[model samples]
Target: MAKPARIRLAGTIAATALCAAAATEAAAQTPPDDSIVLNQQLQLGDVFSHQTLNVVDAQEQVTVSTSAQGNSASGAVENGSITVQSDQDMRGDAVAGTDMTFGGDTWGVVNATTQAQGNYLAVSAYDSDLTVDATQSNTGSLVSATSQLGDDDARLLGGAYINASAISNTVAMYGEGSFVGGTIDQSSSATVRAYNRIETQYIPAEAVIDSQAIVNAVQVTSGQTSGQNLAIVQTSTGAFVEAESSANSGNAWDLAGRARATANQAVLYNEGGSVVADSRQDNTAFVRAAATTTAFDFGRAEAHARGAANELSIGNNDIYVEIDNSQFNSGGVDVTATFSGANGYDVYVGADAVGNSVIGYSCSDCGGYLEARNSQTNDGDVSARADTTVAGSTRAVITGANSVGNSATFHVSRPSH
Candidate 1:
């Protein structure tokens, strides 16, 4: 009688295991119809997320998302602790997602979008210390983002002792409209570091499409500042698209731009250890690094871009169209960001509307562009170091434009190395 009962119990347990396995396989990460999710946990060690959505369709989407103070910190700790906090809120009737059709019906939506980030923190409770109180608070409602159409964007960043990486791409159409808009916004990326603290940001405003109007302003700096860079353009009719991107390697290099900008920066500047750094951007970008505030001291930034629009069909694409779009562009060999530091630099004044793209080259799109149109365009670059340290640099311009369609196009590059 005991043997028979034991056998029966084992069989029941086996059946339950099989049902549980089937349920797990059929499950999906589907949130509520109108959902509000809050997940708070202290996860020490490794973490990962994998999402795959096939032939999806979504539209009339009113997306009011706020992810402020989303940060991470990791490194060698001898009897220490790591803490991260975030607070965010949204208000008002913003003119967004109205009459806006993101992914239309019968329109296969494959959103293969990825935004990657990294944080490096080192602590020695017995010898040294590091404190990171990164906070950004907004008490009153202010209309900072407004009147945006097509592909418009805005970003703000701050922190200390970090490793960051970023990539962005946009195609009027890619892979049969499947990947029409592949924008990795921060919507962008960064890799920075400091044993004690390091603060850096690469802010770029961009827009694309026909009958579209775009205006961009950016500010980057460190300590005191007295430097200028200019890029001006005068157009004459037709399609007038422009993009100005910048990259830097110095522990402190002030930048100001009035157009689109981007970078894949990696810094390996060590004070009392060995460090090696590598920054890469490819077709299907995948970046993974385990570096240090070690001993190696090296950094580099390179950039590249190409544009084309064969809209010679009818007289539809009218008006002035300027593009400050950045996609799959790369900055030179290696970058240096001190993963470990004893003292941090206090930023004083960082201005906006700054540039002179470098360590990279940009190619102009052609085949009879801006035909029979009035255009006055200007592109100028100015660099002011303001009595600071300078590093390696290079500038490349593809001269001899075929014919600018009775238009004025000015190009200038000034490197303050």
Candidate 2:
């Protein structure tokens, strides 16, 4: 649950020396050892390595996220490699809601959120990565909140949200709980509340979310994920990977909802309200919990909607909202591979991977997809895979292998309503 970054000039600085002063501060903040710590110091923010770290902490209790709640919203782009690392043996507020990145093999990352008080919020991405990462033990909470007030004839909306994406880049994140996810909920509602318990997914080229689109008096929430989990990894591109033998990762996404856009509304009084939630996660990038090790990550979503109240309420009232959670862990190899390669020959994947599987499946409210496969024996492109419910979890497991290693159990819980 990261917020939009807070950037303000406290004291006045000579504009002429701003560059020199900033450089000096960045240099002084470098870690003595290769190890680093990312902490959010209460309400004032934290002091950290500015050169290698980039954070986005934005909060709008009144209106909009980091976007235009009326029309369209977008994210910026980076042109170099980057690395995100967090070391926490204990699962406290070591590095709560924050984003930090250094230079490396990966390039470009985006974290975006939006709300539409007029119609519906639209989300799309291209040539970059959009996701959320979480790794925790014992217990933790990550939350994001957005709000909309007043009344209008914007009760329900309709449309198609995405098309295609372009790109070229790599990514890597290491720590206790590692997770990567991109989700969108589009279920129509009517009975004063909309229901969104369906996920229509397809990955002929890349892992994507495309469902029915609409806007209305609907509120959506996600990620109230909780569980015990763990992930240990050791990956590299050298000759061979030598170390242990057991590797494991667990992950989850809970998509539950329902929506009704056009229903019987006795406008004489009111038209009710609409609510939705999607893809809740519970896991970490790296860590060792006291009670368990099989780190867990989760994401939950639901939606309810209806048409604008006609002459009933003297007028019509409508609210539209949309959201998605993005994440990734590895050399940006496991998950990024699924998003980049069109040929499907994940050439760089190596070793005995436990919970590093890409699940691109969806079902109606009645069915689910849960599967777990062990490839450590032969160990093909990847190591393991599982098909559970929309309530999916991502846990990592690494053996002694040649590549980048990441162990995580991240609970990236950010609910916006």
Candidate 3:
């Protein structure tokens, strides 16, 4: 009774409906062992997990978390084009342009996000580590990451613009073991901005016996240079060293070292290094923006020798400091000895020469012996009266209202050494 054209049309509709049902059932099954190749299009539900996704060789489009999971959703277009409607947390490695919008928290450990030419962003990790360990043949640009390590003994290494919010507290034995080690080299620029605090637990025997710890922060900016830019050392016996441009580069060295509440029992040495500003031009080297370029800064080169019979040496034309903010044992002779700087400023030179400058002031509660030399060309201003002492040696040029030039004066008593 039906026409031939109508019969054919009915059969086509039935076939299409059956195919759609079958596809839905297939998606509900376990994740595909191989790659989820979609030549046309594919849509997924709210949950996606326990799957290793490889998008490097994909030319198709696949969307996940369409509707809404709780109050948020996530879907990725290309490598970097990942979008999230609400707050979401992603834990894994994603390529460039994996656009992500999280209304909550993200933690990243051993993850790599490379931004070839466009913009990129990454966030948090639990036990995962994010590594951006690229070679000299690679070029990375416009990459931004905000990361936090929530588990103990976790590490995050590599890349630029990296924000590390936390370090682990678990005990582990290995060389160069820190909660975080961010290494950005080979013409790389890294900026670590954080709003939270990073904590690390102390290991007694392993830390106390180690002579020197290569423990510091690596942070560099603007110029292309090798090694670390910023270095921060928190625990154990280690030296926090940061180096920028070379002294012979004819340019100002962009190097800085900052520390607070760092406890250690370490021995450090500065063999024959010099911190010289380009006397050729009005260039600036070893400067403090908090003070300015011309303030004649102190402690550009610092040494922390805080143990029994420890020694700290500073070369000529170097800034050295020894901050004593640790719980030291009694009868332990922690020495902070400084060599003179270049230009005859070695240990506070005369008006014609730039000698070493000593600035020591202690509160009444701070109990330590304060000694200074070459106060004649400089003034020894002591505010606290806790029996301070400044003994000028035979080879030492001691002055002030008390010695050499009327420039050196020390109110603290000293035993004639």
**TM-score per candidate, chains pooled:** 0.18, 0.18, 0.19
Model 1 lDDT per residue over 1-417, tens place: 999999999999999999998877766454323212222222222222222222113332222221111223322212223222222221111111111112222122111112221221121221112122211111111111111111111111110111111111110100110100111111121121111111122211111110111111111111111111111111111112222222221232222111111222211111111111111211111111111111011121111221111101111011211222112211211111112212222211111221211121111221112222222111322111111121322222111111111122222122221
Order of candidate numbers by TM-score, starting with the best: 3, 1, 2
lDDT of 3 by residue, 279-308 (tens): 000101111000001001121211112111
What's the C-alpha lDDT at position 114 in model 3?
17
lDDT of 3 at 2: 72
Clashes of 3: 52
Question: After best superposition, candidate 1 residue 259: deviation in angstroms?
Answer: 4.9
In candidate 1, stretches whose alpha carbon ends up further than 4 angstroms from where it belongs are: 1-260, 283-417
Write down the TM-score for model 1: 0.18
* 95: Cα error in model 2, Å: 18
Candidate 2: RMSD to truth? 27.7
lDDT of 1 at 304: 23
Superposed on all Cα atoms, the candidates' RMSDs to the truth, in angstroms, are 25.4, 27.7, 26.3
